[model samples]
Target: MKKIALIFSLAVLLVLGLSTAALAATNGPHGGFTTNTASCAQCHKTHTAQSSHLILFALVSGSQNDIYRTCTYCHSSTGSSHYDEVDGEIKDGSNLWATSAGGFQSMPTVEGATSYTTMATVSSKHNADQANNTLVAIPGGSSALKFELRCDSCHDPHGTQNARQLVPTVTVWNTLGTAYNTVSTIPNGAISMTVNNPTTNETITYNDDHINDFCGACHTDYLQTAVNSGSTQSGTYTSGLYRHRVGMAAAGASGYNAAYFALPTSSPAGDVLCVTCHYAHGTTAAVSSTTYANGSTLLRMDERGVCQDCHRKTFSTSQPAVVAASSYQVSATDKNHVVLAFNSYMEKVSAQTAGNYTVTGTGVTGVSSAQLQPNGVLGKTVLLTLNGSLTTGSSYTITVNTTTVKDLNGLAVSSTGNTFTFSSK
Candidate 1:
């Protein structure tokens, strides 16, 4: 009777094991220990163990790192998967496949190539190799821990709840502190993906929380709390510049027009995220262009094309006009100083022409100079300095003549609302 009871308990345990495997992610190509327990043998050896982490691949000389060698063995162009992470190309049955996460630059031909070919150097990217690459500490973070970065540093092959199997907690071996530090992203929201193959459409949705804070796991002080609120620089970074807000709703943001956007957002309300503009793996975007430099900051688009996704200042079909309600404010300290705000991005050469503006009022002199604020690149505010101060309690009229001021697209400012009046302090 006791032997029969033991057999019954064993059967129950077997059923529970199968149920757990059914719930795991179907990452079969990566040796996902799911329904088929035999998949574990693909990456692990019980008796004849090799390198650290029980990895089956024997350590080769001149390899970047242990885990990288293990992953690229099946992820590179010559590997079984043909998802060459080195060159950021994927092979879908002899055809190149494209994914949201773009590819990297440097790639090797064999398991242990003597020298690597430098195709192109991406301006910005996460360090995946510690042996042959320079170690860059986490930005916005002040941790004094020195460590080696690997591919598995941010990804978990066993499968996870986060999108793309991103591990919730990252463990780094600190060589300086002689210990291990684990950065966590618990209590934050989840980022998920939905692929509709038949329709050839894919949508990524951010839930209640965002990925900005998830990336904040290592980027300690880059947390953005509210929409339109600027992120404060803490830790080591001391740059006091106003920055764009992330991890917040993008639909109702001041400069963002949802109708013009081609990116996905959170359900019900879309929130801007870190990955919304950047590629996690790497990018080959250009760093210099006619309008701007420093463009290749691991962005998904070339130059500032990502900025045009929502700003749309250069894409307006209507004539450029002054924003009356938010413009024409007299400075409290100096009555001669005033500000005028425009609705569209203006042409620097046209907007900064002092002769294009006229000031007429009591005790007011002619305009001295007109300068675009924020150094004029994509700036909409014009700061005007007057020749003489305006008397307090006096009304003044500022006129922007027709065909004088033009938008970035060379559209002249509208003639109807070209005149504005303001009362001096």
Candidate 2:
């Protein structure tokens, strides 16, 4: 019996040992001692340390930007890694040369004059260069959190549980409080990028849904709560706040194309995060379109192509139709107030004219006024006020005149689909 017990104890020990090994962290290259201790010498030195933090500067011969050179040794266009962030290309021994977060800046020539201008159109970048990046107050953070930007400021060389080895902690300003007094950790899995080389025929996927949480770590004021489709305005200001809502569902068959805006897991559709429109690294994309001519802000597409891709307002030649699902929210304070939501962006002047609408229902009177929501001039919803109050729990019908209410593309609202019914609050 004693011999049998010893054999069982040995089996249990083996299982525990295997479990511990499986849970070990495998931080890539810079530090994952459990996987390989040899990686330490690649960046650190014991006796021949060249720089502070024992960083081995022997890899590159540049002293001006030694710290930046170390990271770029494996991450730049001339480096050995699959991701060429310096050139914003994925060079997996293939000809695809797909652009991602556009490169940091122009690549340095072989002569080391730093005048390579392959992506010169990408006028702006994160500026991770150690020599050039200056000490500045964080965009959405407090004065107390002033920091000189660097590659290590955002990335953790030692590794982390989050994707891309993002730094775990940052000091952010609390807008609700009087002082810069919030220390926060980026939520796990808020931003993740998966890319495979074409030589291996791998797919590149980026599902950075809560990326605002990561960017908001420093740009605190830019983060916003999600709003609904009908209430989402394009450009309007009220009480010092812009009405361009982020973190909202970019859903609906009529408003957005499912193919161009497909997300990994958006239930019925995808939500719009910060990275949805902007590239994380940087972009060399040109922006010379007539509608939205602007400087490079690391956008995925040129000019306002990112906006038009999902909004699809300019692309629509189809007649506008009322979306019954979102149009039914009536004002509780004023029973006469009713909101109408359309699938396409409507022209402000025509949609807000009272002469273009007629209201008929139980205990209803003449239409008093029609007004588009102050949210946007090119928004999808319009508010209507009746001359009299609607009966509680009573149904009402409204009609939009054909050829009067038009979309931004000058297509009239469909007369056949003009009539809609809503219950009074």
Candidate 3:
């Protein structure tokens, strides 16, 4: 019995030793550690001890903080030691290159340059943010904002190559219904092109998406753009209209809108490009409380303010004014009014019997006075039916008001006027 116990103890000890060895191997150099790949060492260094943080990269000359250099090393196009050129232009163009066709005064350029005639502004272009690494709050103070432009944020460098270096595939909703859950695979539309490095003859395919997909990924206002361009394209907008002018004209009978093609369809409008509204880098928000305190990082102002940069009138003043509802109550058993289908034989009461009168107001339009039917000689009665799910014991007010309300046709109430009142039954 003693000999058997000794053998069991040795077996347990061996098992624990093997477990520890496996755990270390999973995390240690020979097992999983890899260079030319993403790892903690890719961005940080431990043994050098030159800087307090011991970052792998050197410090930027003019920046006050250490993190600035880490980002500028890869982002700054002019000073970097590693670079390639395509045709006469730099392969990965300088960070200062203009991103827009119609340039703005505030966009950044190579160190001492005055303006970037090529970059687009946020109001007109779709590009990544490269300005600063200051955290801001999302609207409604829901969550802290992301400040840095990391490789993983927009691209998955380790995953399979894709347009824009996207990690996986893109999918979008297809229809609307109560359950309204359907999606369709977005086809791969991006490709890479080989550019001949005149000196070395090395070939590099710069991965990029079709012009429309490149811009649409970030700029979600595609439908609005289509409407402005007078394109009769159909999309997922509430009005079933495509709002942008970038993508292919939606084909099939279901996607076409006759009103959008008032002009000849053959003469297509100008294509919408990615740089139409944004700068690749170097625009900053003002320090004002109204603009910056609630705005996004690298954004000049709040979304509403950015929208106003192009759509000045839509947000400037309230048009298509709406009347505020002063009071309302819901009751399952309370009396309410109703309108019956049109019938010519029904005696339409006039002002002589004002007591048993029909009431109308601007509160709800599309309900014509002619549709109202009198209950008796005095009290205008309306049959109210409660849906089964409505609360049984609740109380409600049935209001009736008389005022000259116009319809969609712009017709006013006849001189007979209208009535308004509310009752709790």
Q: Best candidate, TM-score-wise?
A: 1
Q: Which stretches of candidate 2 lie over 4 Å from their true place?
A: 1-28, 59-66, 94-96, 106-121, 130-133, 171-183, 189-193, 196-208, 228-239, 252-254, 259-269, 288-294, 316-425
| Winner on lDDT (1 vs 2) | 1
Off by over 4 Å in 3: 1-55, 61-68, 74-78, 81-133, 136-152, 155-211, 223-242, 249-272, 275-425
Task: Say which candidate scores most in lDDT.
Answer: 1
Please give each candidate's TM-score: 0.57, 0.54, 0.30
How high is the CA lDDT of each candidate model?
0.58, 0.56, 0.29
lDDT of 2 by residue, 297-323 (tens): 766544565666566664655688887
Model 1: per-residue lDDT, tens digit, 52-75?
678765644445877777776655
Whole-model lDDT for model 3 versus the true structure?
0.29
lDDT of 3 by residue, 323-391 (tens): 211111222232232322111111223211223333333332222222211211111122222222223
> Clash number for model 2?
3
Worst 10 residues of 3 by lDDT: 81-90
